[model samples]
Target: MAPPSFVSQEEFHAFHTIDRKLYTLLVINLWRDPVESMQVIALWLWLERVGFKNVVQKILSLPYILTNELADEAVTCLNVINNDQLASLTEGNDTPLMQSLIDRDLSLQFFDKHRLIATQGITRIVNEVCIRALRDIMQHAIERNAAQSLADSQKVISHSLQQPMVQPGLPQVGFGPDADVELPWTQESEVPPDDRTMFVTFSKGYPVHEWEVREFFTRAYGDGIESLHMQEVPPDEQSLFARIVFCSESAIEIILSGMSKAKFTINGKHVWARKFVPKRLKPSLPAAPPVNLPV
Candidate 1:
């Protein structure tokens, strides 16, 4: 009705025709091959980075897709299923993910016992089917995203290797043929290094700021950095030294190795990276050569 308010009767009819066709196409595809069609949809949404909340909003946007009150009900149902209180009610026996089914009233006995879940309009059997459907859909979305990412990465590497030579100024720098090399196999006695912090010494009079250095590391490694800071450098150095701490020691090895091998430069000056080693205190003098009173 709102759509009719905004457009001519003929135009509204034409739009409705196309909308029905879209629904038919979706249903037909699902009916023909459910798994593959679901996967195709999952991949598309995953690639587009569409979140569950966005889907809800999008549905509410289209009057033909969902009415106002129905949309509210849908949102209410989602809140009910994703409730944190449901997980708490289960005690430590269930994780948030496992408690999702319980919250949806998949179990009849559990549903009857819990007033919160039973009050929902859907019956236990319906809830059970809906919960399973949600899990399958989510699982497909996650798997497709991971698989697509891996395949895309491999394709990029393959394309780079096939290229005749690196570009002149914008050289693709790394470990070259050994770029994909892995760390040596671990032994039983060996443990990962605890320190992931690195000292980055920018060249004297470097034109870049401390944030730029942090951004560079983030681009090379990843986000979720513990801390990044710029401290006064030695008088001879002139420029500042950046201390970047990572959440894990593996981040240090991987990021630094990637940087060292790549030899990346900014503002026409090379940035130097090294492990942050603490200076050891010198041993105390041998009791001042025994000149004082001997105990």
Candidate 2:
């Protein structure tokens, strides 16, 4: 996508809510074919040029939003970044994200307590970085949780982190009209069925009713032929909690893409039958012989 008209932080601030669908499409397209990586980098520099040291801070400050396919796509974006880029992005002392990744339980607790609402006045680059951090943390949490039962979880986790094919109809960065244009189709599944489950949780205080759980599954699955199941377990004896599980990966993607209404404890410390294992990515284009460009 050609970069969207440079939106000012003040304008982003005026809008209190994010259109989850729109943002998801934008982010996914950007991640897939990043013609404007330099543009986004420029935007980040623009904010820095204007003396907004807190721009990154503001972007990172967004509470995690459970809407659209964003939570998933955010993870995909992080997966694309090279280790050098990730290291450069994470220059800080607290490193809450790194800490969260090292320990799944702490990350879950942190996400449970803090919620991402909207990015008001935060620069786009900063927003991307923040979301990337959140996704990476969750990805690690999922991996750690699955490690407990590695034999079973490997396939599930592998499928969850699978890369999507660039279809012809999808809105690509250079192939699109508006850089931030929203795609019309439903979000496709990156991971196939049999290797996935959507693990939704009830808050410690509010337990999900059996009826609500049934409806949640029904509504989440839509017209898909996947069987979803829920299990209730307490995190601690003192805690009354439950997990609404969708044992099909396609079903999980369906639920995440279509429904974002019901509030559930996402990023919890549960055994996800899926994890992320990174592999070297081959360049899409053949390398050109070394050529010097005029200075």
Candidate 3:
């Protein structure tokens, strides 16, 4: 098949090398299934759009692309075939040494039967090649997306690290011995229930077990956890949110104090913690004393 208009000379030459190697392997089995010609045509059509070099590169790099035993064998056979042999096969318009072997068999009655088989199975061969090509394209896209998502996550983590640890609305308390620190919520009894509760959010794509959350708080802020509740999330949900109530309001203050955001790393993912503020209900006005009308 002629090189497509979209492909450069270099790309076409590289694809031609792969084609020859594949053809060498196929010819050995041509007697069983003689649809190599149609398969080659379909591959060329896919190459025209995907680019010959790109297809070869993706196939070689992606392990997932080799889904079946047949594909594995084909790749192994292609690797074993010498480059010089492939080059010699396409050196000139005259039939190559390998092609002569196949051509010489054309006089046999079996050759005619194989030719008929190739004609009859052309549609099936084309469909199979097209399906394989589409699969490769989709797999490549998925791999690329996964890599990009990982990169974006890293960027977000880096930015979070650079942010100032001192957050507004939270007391700026220091760990030094004579820092004159004053706790925002002095006593557990005086603090509202919401002030002692922390709203926790977990990073997407990372597994966060209840044990891990309990361990993180217990280790980082002391054994002040009264209750830990994690919301059930759909399987497709990227992040998880939870509520953690502490026995002492000081635990919440310690978690939020001096931090721009109450963020922690758990299970290799960023977890955010903030004090849960409950909405205040408006006070109901008492009915005025019944007025005596024109007594």
Candidate 4:
């Protein structure tokens, strides 16, 4: 019998090859009881259709079936099932037993099975494609939000650096040499007064030495720093703090000018600097000499 017209030449050739093998096997057993041979052929055809339907269902159910092209390919592959060949196998048998085997409605069942499998396969492919598309959209949205957040943070930092620093309850004073400065007292005489010192703090978990501080300031301010001292930390503390004493008090003003917070990037670490402010001493209470008469 001729191959199905819907399939390609290559597909038809493959189908014809398999069909010839099956036909040869049936002819080999044709000399046996005719009724038993026909029954065997009917059973074989039913099993083949059932197995093909099962395999098609499994492949279509996979989540990776992401396009309509794949569904089209699956339908093309299924078209290789040629019912004409199956019908031809029972052509010469005119007995009532052979007619009974053909009339069992196997062709109707196969047609229904093929239509159902095709519908389910197309539905699964469409669903997987939609899911993947939504996943890509959500990923793009997350990346866009992250990029916007980064831009906003940079703008905030730039704006903050442009504004002048304001210390609450302290008068806004000029950095000029003639400006009157109130120097905060300190117990350590070796360290310069608060007006000439810049209190420096390093980012936690970074190792910093005195030489780095001296080198950083001398390079920036042209040898204006008088002394650099790294504070001795307690065993429990991990933070590093330093006292930078410049020869001229103007160095502190120059570094902190026009910025709300003086910050520097040293050796890829963030370091903050500010004019040193000491804790004020409270005034002494008046004597109770007026209460001597009552005693």
Candidate 5:
């Protein structure tokens, strides 16, 4: 059905009033809906820019920059600083990074001319901030520019029917279902038990509930993994999750595969079952070479 339109000024006013009221309610209630909260912050920011109070602008912008959804927007603001806005704001002469670097250089120059080294610290702090900003900008720019290249490179290549079947781990695997074939995991027992049990461990400090994990697995891998048991690590533990058991190899494969899809990792490294080695299996390595050697 077609929606009603607010064509008149009075109708528009009423709509705006309702929208603002709802947004205020959400904020007051501490709503966790990030997208909605971000939109409210954006609305407030716009209003502030159009001659609202400076204090209110500061307040609204703080949450906007700090909130997860709006953090990307904050990064966008940082990009503007790196690109030109902050420079233009600073008497149209210096950007934050540029000002830091130039200020340091000037301080160093002053010290050098006066035969003094006391200004070195001032130069060091300024130089570091400037360098950090420059590095950040470079990273942002490179990632920005690479988006197109990444998309282009992701295009699927046609493979001939006569080609031999390559293994899953190899680069020759096509970007299709064949690339996602489930690895084999079987028990040695001749007759498998009717009830299979899986072990699951979650990292400490994870906000998600145990039942959520089960639901996630159910949706991600239907009938693949069965009967998940969650054991919570200590609150002070570094890892958010760990120590899971699976009744069968199939269940383990399903769980691991789902984990990979969700980008869960150990220490920021992608872990696949085939690539994962137990600590016992990992060979002890020799100690590192001495940092200082005799000349």
Candidate 6:
């Protein structure tokens, strides 16, 4: 379904400073969450823009152009700044990574800039009121924007708003029946009791939760997984592994074949599955661990 367009293409083509900033913030939020549907983003964008009481469009000075080397350093350090709350995490006279690279004041200013933007942008949205208000706004926009006929816009907004958040993980829908109950990722078992179980290995850094493991398989091979157990790799170790017990040997073979159909990834890196073998028989070095979660 097509998302409602509150700001017509004509409105955006003629966006003043404030409208542009709101639009930019909406884009930032979009990047931060790919799962977020477009209609919800448009609603939130309109909500924040109207909720804030600001009229005068202030012309601010442009950002300083950095030397190639300085720019590289700034980008690298700031890219590592995963949390917006890093400013609070720093100690007395202990600068954040941003401060170390760009010096304290600019770091603080940079932090404040994004901080104010996030706070002013998303903070106004209180959950209970947001939905009711958003419906009204989208309805009004649909009515006003003769270009957006009622049939399409209504479906988009309803679906976008009603779509459940994927939660901290996706569903454990597929995989065969081997172990009737799902096993803990850290099951104390030294080996799979049966041939139906297989191990999937990927580079570790991000927490490989049971649901994530289940979701990967479901996406890669369709679900019927009976049980999944994640073996705890050393925290500092590079490679991560999980044991998935399928209902049939065919399920294990389908994944171990590593064909395009079975191939899948965690954070874009390829994951390989094989029949569970004892650590004593298999010899492999630890792979590099993931440094940070994608922002």
- Give me the candidate number with maximum lDDT: 3
TM-score-sorted candidate list, best first? 3, 4, 1, 6, 2, 5
Point out where model 6 deviates above 4 Å.
Answer: 1-193, 233-239, 258-263, 279-295
lDDT of 5 by residue, 118-185 (tens): 22332342343222212232333334335534544444232344346787877864557556444456
State candidate 2's TM-score. Answer: 0.23
Give lDDT for model 6.
0.41
Model 3 Cα lDDT, one tens digit per residue, 125-221: 3564333323333343345445545766888899789755887899865656675554566645466667788876654346577898999889977
lDDT score of residue 130 within candidate 6: 34
Greater lDDT among 1 and 4 belongs to 4
TM-score of each: 0.28, 0.23, 0.31, 0.31, 0.21, 0.26
Q: Which clashing pairs does model 3 show?
A: 165-259, 165-260
**Which of the two, 2 or 3, has more TM-score?**
3
Off by over 4 Å in 4: 1-192, 234-239, 283-295
How should the candidates be ordered by lDDT, best one leading?
3, 4, 1, 6, 2, 5
* Higher-ranked by lDDT: 3 or 5: 3
Worst 10 residues of 3 by lDDT: 90-99
Q: Per-residue lDDT for 175-268 in model 4, tens only?
A: 5656544345723454346678777765445656678778887788788887787766566654356777888787888988954236677788
Poorest lDDT segment (10 consecutive residues) of candidate 2: 271-280
- TM-score, candidate number 5: 0.21
Q: 283 in model 6: Cα distance from truth in Å?
A: 23
Q: In model 5, how large is the Cα lDDT of residue 22?
A: 31
Q: Give the per-residue lDDT of model 1 (tens digit) for 13-61.
A: 3434432232222323122123333332332122123222333223323
Q: Where does candidate 4 clash, by residue pair?
A: none
**lDDT, model 1:** 0.41
